[model samples]
Target: MDFLNYTEGVFATNTSGNDSLETTKLPTSKVLLTVTLSIVAILTTFFNCLVITAIAVTRKLHHPANYLICSLAVTDLLVAVLVMPFSIMYIQMETWIMGKVVCTIWLSVDITCCTCSILHLAAIAIDRYRAITDAVEYSRKRTGARAGAMVAVVWLLSILVSLPPLLWRHFSEEGDLEDQCIIIHHHLAFTLYSTFGAFYIPLLLILILYYKIYKAAQTLYMRREASRASRHSCMTNGSMIPSSFTAGDGDIDGGPRSPDPISPPEKSFSEPSTEEPPREKVRASVKAFKRKTRRPESRSESRRSQLYQGPRISGSRERKAASTLGLIIGAFVICWLPFFVKEVIVNTCGSCSTSVEMADFLTWLGYLNSLINPLIYTIFNEDFKKAFQRLVRCSNYL
Candidate 1:
């Protein structure tokens, strides 16, 4: 297999160029890659920074949902500033020039930031689901302390997961050969850590939470429809009964008075009293008060629902947000999957040489996942867009 050949070449060869590879000195490709990556890095960094600033400054944005968004922004910012620049530099150099210390740091930051980003996304999904599913209950539970604990746990887990690779991995120049970094006797361990800790577990949790949230939203909508129907029925019946009774009383009193000019004293005395106007005025006043009162109450209820139960509209805005997140996550999986697969194939078969160029390309692509997230969020989320625009406008005006 390709893995066997690659491993054999690495173990047996001392030269930089292996038999199974084609070396290139394409300055144009190098420049293009560097320029593109640099531009992406700058934009991503600036965007995420804006996200953090906007959330911090805007009190209305300071909620659990946006708190998680802030966390995500921070993670993306780290990736953009710390990870992406080095990756671009590495690609430009076409070799690991920074010694073992920098390499370890790079690896740690890369894993930690990516892991934290994924975890933050998962947390946001859960928060949104709870807001929609058990809005009242979620509001009561999602206190500052609770949010703090969640953020703390996310960072702690990210650090823990990132530490393992640095602990076991090292780089050394073997004779006159090019210096290469490799995990020491821990390929399987790294695979498991990367797969389960980063991708598989988080994806599973997100899918399940969103599914429940979707069902809960549907139930709430149905209940609202039913309540509206019943209220309309009651109003119709109430108005009809009052009008019919008033008309009947009017007819009976008028008919007797006109027909019997010389009416008996008892017959006149037995006639129903006409105090209906005052009673109707009172009823009308009560209705007017109810209508006025209900307006504010309805508004309050809507705000409450929005605050506790996630977004009000599951329309294009929401779908677009979901799609953006899904796209980033999907890209992450696709880009990183190759690296792991390459590692597994080489470890198991020991046939093909590890394509350093391909591996580097894939790794950088994976890091690019972080850079895309902030852009995705800003594009899909209107609140983020508005805040960003306002911030820009204010800056320009100032």
Candidate 2:
């Protein structure tokens, strides 16, 4: 009996010690999570601020197109400042730190900012597509007022998508219900509505807009290449023409002229010609030959001018912008699709199982999209690139 009691005591002690050690390690993981969240928040704020500053300070970047970009940066900045910190706290604590009112506000801001960010992308894609395919019309119609209206509409739609949750969510007198800030994913109507509006609809629009943009861009490139090939052929044939002329200016008789019917009839007698070349005639012939020789050169210069001053140059710029937009769209989908998919699954399927940690990871991944948007949009832009260089290199001058 004594030996059995001793063994049980040792086992109990070991188990208690192990439990305490595990509890102690929990804070370490929490600290790591906190640090990671802080870093993400800082990066999101810093990069987005850089983009906004670059656009605002750079005079050339102050166009209707970049106005949309600035709006996107603002939305992302809000996510970093207003949404990310709260998100980090919730992730670490596994419960809401603020009260019900603050919780409601936070969720609203979260949805509003993310949805606004996404809508801005769709807006930008639309702008680029129009600019690519109907440049003259888009330039005529694109205005600050229109862009401002677009921004307003984006926020309004975001509010509509987010507000439904606030109506259904309530603070119950049960455990964690009052304290936990959660979107009421269990409500079937709100779930499908929010998910479809906030994600699915925007995704469909982006896909369609980008698809059209891609096709239009491809056609633009094909036309440009065809023009370039024709130009090259012209230049090549021009060079060969001169080479052939140097070999021989075909027969002096001006080759195979049809006989004029008004000429003397076939029976008319022809006198033997003893013609001598005159000095004035020789001078005029020399001048005319010189003009003809220079004519080919002048034509070549004109062709060169046309090659440089045609649709080709503008097409290249359009192609570059299209490629940049493509990259931004691709990155957006990659970052947000997973989180949106998870949200749809959890909300639409009542019996769906999801790990809390996995959900948190997906949420943060979507948040990281906000961080990347500025980098792709601004940094890849030539004007933005020069502006950034100026800002970094000539701060005092500005």
Candidate 3:
């Protein structure tokens, strides 16, 4: 009896000690998660705020086209400020931190801002397409007010897409609903509706617009290259003819350094005409070659002048559009597709099980897109880089 009692006491003490340690201490994984999320949130906030400041201060960045970019930065900034921190806290706690009201607000802002960011991409694509396809007309129309109106429309549409969930997304007074804050994954119809509206529809539009934009840009680039090749070929032929004539003269005139117009140089080959000497024949051939070479000078000059002046600025713009569009579409699709696809699969297939950890990871993956936006914008845009350098040098407001 004494030995049994001692064993029971030891087992109880060990179990109690473990329980206390478990409750008080966080694992390495959780600590890493917290640190990683905090860093992402901070970087996202800093980068996006830098973009806004750069745009505000730099005169060169003050273009109608860049206004849409500023709006995107604003949207991503809101996501970093309002959505990510709350999400990090909720993930660490393994439940919602704030009450239902705050949860509803946070979820709504998350959806609206993310949707707004996606819509901003679509809007910028349209702006680029118009600029490329109809540069003359669209330049007139691409004003500051026009970009502002598009930004307004994007926000309005995002809010409308997120509003329906509020009507049916009330937390219950009891059970599993009270502690968790998640999207309406149970309703297949709304899930399809929101995901399609927010991501898929805009994705389709981007695909079609970028396809046409790529085609137009390709044609312009090919034409420019062809004109250059033609000029180069004419110039090469002209130069070679002059060199061949110089060599012919040196061979004919006993290694004379220069050609004398009055004196016809000698040549070994004959034209087989009794009326003309070899020297006369060579002189006539030289004159004929000169005429042929000089004939194309006028045409080449006209083409060269046009090449120097025409489409130079638009070429840079088109290149930027091409490079930036490809990257934006790729990043957008990679970051958000898994989460939306998971939602679609789990919601449509009622028998599918949803893991909270999986859902949270996918949601944060989508949120990672917000962080990617500013990086893509600043890295690709030369104007942004200059402005950022200037802003960093003179950052009183930071």
Most lDDT-accurate candidate: 3
What are the TM-scores, per candidate, against the unseen true structure? 0.67, 0.72, 0.72
Stretches of candidate 1 exceeding 4 Å from the true structure: 1-25, 170-178, 181-186, 233-354, 378-381, 395-398
Best by TM-score: 2
**Which portions of model 2 show Cα errors greater than 4 Å?**
1-22, 170-176, 239-326, 394-398
lDDT of each: 0.60, 0.68, 0.70
lDDT tens digits, residues 1-398, model 1? 01111242211323565432423456677688789889988888887888899888766677766777788899889888888887777656555577767766766777788788878867877777666655555667877677778888899987787666555443322212334423333355565665567656877787787667555545554444343334334434443221112111111002211111211222222222466577776676677667766754565464345433433453443464456556645665675556546655665553544555565555566666666666755576667777778898875321
Ranking by TM-score: 2, 3, 1
Query: What TM-score does candidate 1 get on C-alpha atoms?
Result: 0.67
> What's model 2's overall lDDT?
0.68
lDDT of 3 by residue, 23-92 (tens): 4675777789889988989999999999988888778788988899899999999999998888788767
lDDT of 2 by residue, 247-327 (tens): 111111122212112222223122223463576566666776677668657766765676565566657767775677678
The root-mean-square deviation over C-alpha atoms between each candidate and the true structure, in angstroms, is: 15.4, 16.0, 16.2
In angstroms, give how far residue 2 of model 3 lies from its true place.
Answer: 58
